[model samples]
Target: MTTVAVFRPADERLDDAVALLESLGATPVPDPMLEVDPTGVCPREDADFAVLTSKTGAELAEAEGWDAQTTTVCAIGDPTADALRAAGYAVDVVPEEFSSGGIVSTLEGRVDGARVEVARSDHGSDVLTDGLNDAGAYVHETVLYRLTRPDGAGESADRAAAGELDAALFTSSMTVENFLAAATERGVREDALAGLNDAAVGTIGDPTRETAAAHGIDVDVVPERADFESLARATLAAAE
Candidate 1:
């Protein structure tokens, strides 16, 4: 039986990945590699536009009393836009392609002189903010969450060593680092990575590919876009 390991944290949003794997007749295994903490980050205010890169960022903004009425919100993809809309934000833009480059491109002509505030995890890349700044838009950033290594490293690594997973999906570079850390902690680094090689290694975008390659693991698939659905379809194609 083929088993697909999901390396994201345990969240209600994982339902899509779980359902997708089930539809492909692959065993679904939840091997969360990281955890999200909403504390320890500050929020910013007063901007022409608000950039939301993840659903977690949306949740954080909602928690921090950010009103969407005065700010035009931009989402990285449809799912994030959905989250923003549900949070009562007026989502003005959602790129068809969900990568940072796509988001930047979508905002090129749209935000020439606008002050854009970016809300994201503490360790997130600065590609969006930097690109926006270079495009003549004043960009402010708010780190609303932090990602930590999971405490269940041993168990997750043991499952990898047992050869139960046919593949592992990585949505971000942090996920790659955390998964490798888990494998190292369990003293099964070689076995875990070998299991990944035997099956498939799925990356959401170029940055994720770089992260996987730095660990000497050749990524097997990268979706055209960086959304969860695109990554899942790429993983399924790689499995076939």
Candidate 2:
């Protein structure tokens, strides 16, 4: 049986990844690398637009009682766009690729002079905000959550070292960094990461691919779209 490891920290996203794996007839093993604190705050206002880069960010905005009334919600990709719609927000834009760069490119010509609020994690890069600002949008960012490495990083590393996984999926650069840090803490960083080369090493996009490459791990698969479904399909294709 082919086993896929999901490295997403959030339970909700991990569950979605596992479900996608099952639908593809692959066995999924949860190997969350980080934990999310869902109670962070992202200041929301009746802006002309809102940007959601991750499902966690979207959830945080919804929790903060962000009114979607006549406001255009732009998501990084389809999955995040789905989340925004589920939260009763009008999804105005969804990039074909799901990355900060992709979101920036999609909004380059569209957001000029627009008041846009971005909801995201505490430690995320300023690429989106900076890009929007450069494009003449009045951009405000609010941190909605924090991500910490999981406590069971050692055991997770052990599983990887034992070759129990056929592939590992990384949705973001942060996930790659946290996974490596966890493995290093367990003294099995090399072994755990080396196991990935034998199987399919999947990334969501270019940024994540760069992160994996920085650690000397080559990414074998990158989906056209940065969603779990696309990642799963790419993983299967790479495995083939």
Candidate 3:
């Protein structure tokens, strides 16, 4: 069976990812590189618009019983929008492009002179706020969660360095950074990268792909759709 590495948070998300890989006939190396640390902060109810960038963010916001209070809700992608809707929030916008730039483009004209609340993880890209600002939206960011690599999480890094993984899935730029950090901690950064280069790599989105590129990692798969299942299936299929 093809051996694949997945770097989701050490939660139900990781379990679901592992199950998906197993169902696809791949041996999964479930090394979680990100852990969620909620900030106990909620989006201000006074904003004209609110944005959710991840499913986790949607869940967290709902947990807080977040009342948009007339704020139009927007999500960057379908998954996020679905998450919001499932949480009983009415989604008013979701960009066709499924990215920060895409969302900014979708709302640029309408958000001018409007207050936009951004609720997501600490690793959110500056491209989001900058573009919103450039478009004349008053943006306020509320960090719903902070992502940190779990301790003793380098098994996949070791496997990658040993040329044991057939493919690897990176969901976010932070996951890529944390994976490389794990390799560095094991003093196998260069070797691990070499091994990964010999295998297939996939990133969930363009920002993640650019991060991998900046770190000299070669990406073989970037699905037309920005979702985990698509990313994993595409990478595993490429590995085969």
Candidate 4:
């Protein structure tokens, strides 16, 4: 059986990833590499619009008692939109392309003079902030959480370096960065990357692809649709 490595944050998404891999006849290795902890950052209560790029940020907003109903909510994609909806926020906008650049494109002229609040991870990209600002929106960007790789991250990288893994699924750019950081910490960065080269590399979206490329990894599998099942199918196809 082909062993598929999933090194995402240990969250609600892990079960879905594991199940998707299993349904596709791949052995799922649930090696959660990262953990998300709240940084206690909160968005402004008087903002006219709120932005969410990831489900983690949405989760944080919900936990922090954000009154989403009073603010216009925008999400980058379906998953984040779904999360915001589940948390009682009516998602007003979801960019068609499901990316930060997409958000910039979608909200181009509409953000003028709007007070926008961006809630994301501690080290999130500033594309939305800059884009909204350029579009004349007053943006207040807040870091709702931080990502930290635990010891299991290094172990997962070690397994890959030992050639025990056949494929790796990356849902976000941060996962790639954290995984590589783990490999570097183990002093097997080059060897781990080399071993990964022999395995199928799967990415969920453009951000992950760009990040993987920056790290010199060629992505072999990409789904036309940005979803877990599509990614799983793409990974299986590339592995075969």
Candidate 5:
């Protein structure tokens, strides 16, 4: 059985990823790399459009009683859209590309001369805001949360360093960065990176793939869809 490493936050998402791996016959190493630290902030109410980049952002926004007022709501992907809808917010846009660049494209012509509010975590890429600004939209970003790596989060790094991990699913660039931070803290950065490179690795999107590449980690798979199941199955197949 493949021994795979995952780094989702400690939540239903992590549980679901583990369950999915088990259902697929892989032994999972659920090493959560992110812990959400809510910033107690919400989207600005005066914007013409509001964009949510993650399910966590949507949940936080909902908890803050964010009202659309006169703004159109948008999500970066189906997951975020579902979360917003579940919270009783009407999702008006979900880009086909399911990424910052994709959302930029989706709102390009429409957002010209519009006030766009972006609600997301602290580590959100500048691409979206810059793209929107360049496209003639006044963009304001609210940091809804900050992602911090939990203490003692490097066990999977040790396992990887020992050549025991068969695959790794990197859902975001921050996961890759936090995983490296964990490995470095364990004093196994070099060995862990070497072993990790030997195993099959999948990144959910191009941004994550690029981040891994910048660190000299060769990503073996990047599924067509930027989702966990697709990334895991594709990486496991590559590992075999």
Candidate 6:
């Protein structure tokens, strides 16, 4: 059986990553590198616009009672938009690229002189802020959640060092950083990465791939779609 290393944060969406691995005939090694903790903050419901980059942010918005009836809601991707819709928010914008650049493009003309509120992860891209400001929107960015290193981070690093993992799935830049920290703690940072160099390296999107590259890991598979299921299929194919 193909043992795939899962290095995403432990969250509601983690099950989706595991399920994708199973569907692709891979045994998931659950060594979550991070966890998302809410900052108990929300965007202004009275703002002219709101931006959401992740499901966690959307959930936080819902918890903070951010109604979208008056605010123009913009989501970075379909998943985020779906979360908002499920919470009874009407998403007015969804980028085609599912990145900060995409969000910037979507709000290019509409944000000038507007009050834009962004509820997102602490580690979210600065592109959105910069873009909004450049477009003359008074932006208020709130840290909705933080991604911190979680337990069992060293498990996948250890397995990689032993050549037991067939693939390593990286869903975020934070995952890459935490995985490396785990490997470093095990004194197998080089060996683990070397082993992973031999195995299929799966990345969720361009940002994760850039993070992997910064660590000298040339990704073997990058999903055409920036989602876990696509990442799993690409990893399986690359491993084959």
**TM-scores of the models, in the given order?**
0.91, 0.90, 0.98, 0.93, 0.98, 0.95
CA shift of 240, model 4, Å? 0.7
Angstrom error of the Cα, residue 116, model 6: value is 1.4
Worst 10 residues of 3 by lDDT: 60-69
Per-residue lDDT over 56-102 for candidate 6, one digit per residue giving the tens place of the 0 to 100 score: 78888899876678888899888899999999988899988888888
184-215: candidate 5 lDDT, tens digit per residue? 98899999999999999999989999999999
For candidate 4, list the clashing residue pairs, or say none.
none
The lDDT of model 1 is: 0.79
Best candidate per TM-score, number?
5
Question: What's model 2's TM-score?
Answer: 0.90
Over 4 Å off, model 3: none
Per-residue CA lDDT of candidate 2, range 67-184, in tens? 7776778888776787778888888888776778788999889889999888888767678889989999998887788888877754556777787777878888888888888888
Give the C-alpha miss distance for residue 140 in model 4, angstroms: 0.6
Clashes of each: 0, 0, 0, 0, 0, 0
Ranking by TM-score: 5, 3, 6, 4, 1, 2
Off by over 4 Å in 5: none
State the lDDT of candidate 1 residue by residue for 59-89, as single tens digits. Answer: 7788788876777788987777888788877
Superposition error at 97 for model 2 (Å): 2.6
> What's the C-alpha lDDT at position 33 in model 5?
94
User: What TM-score does candidate 6 get on C-alpha atoms?
Assistant: 0.95
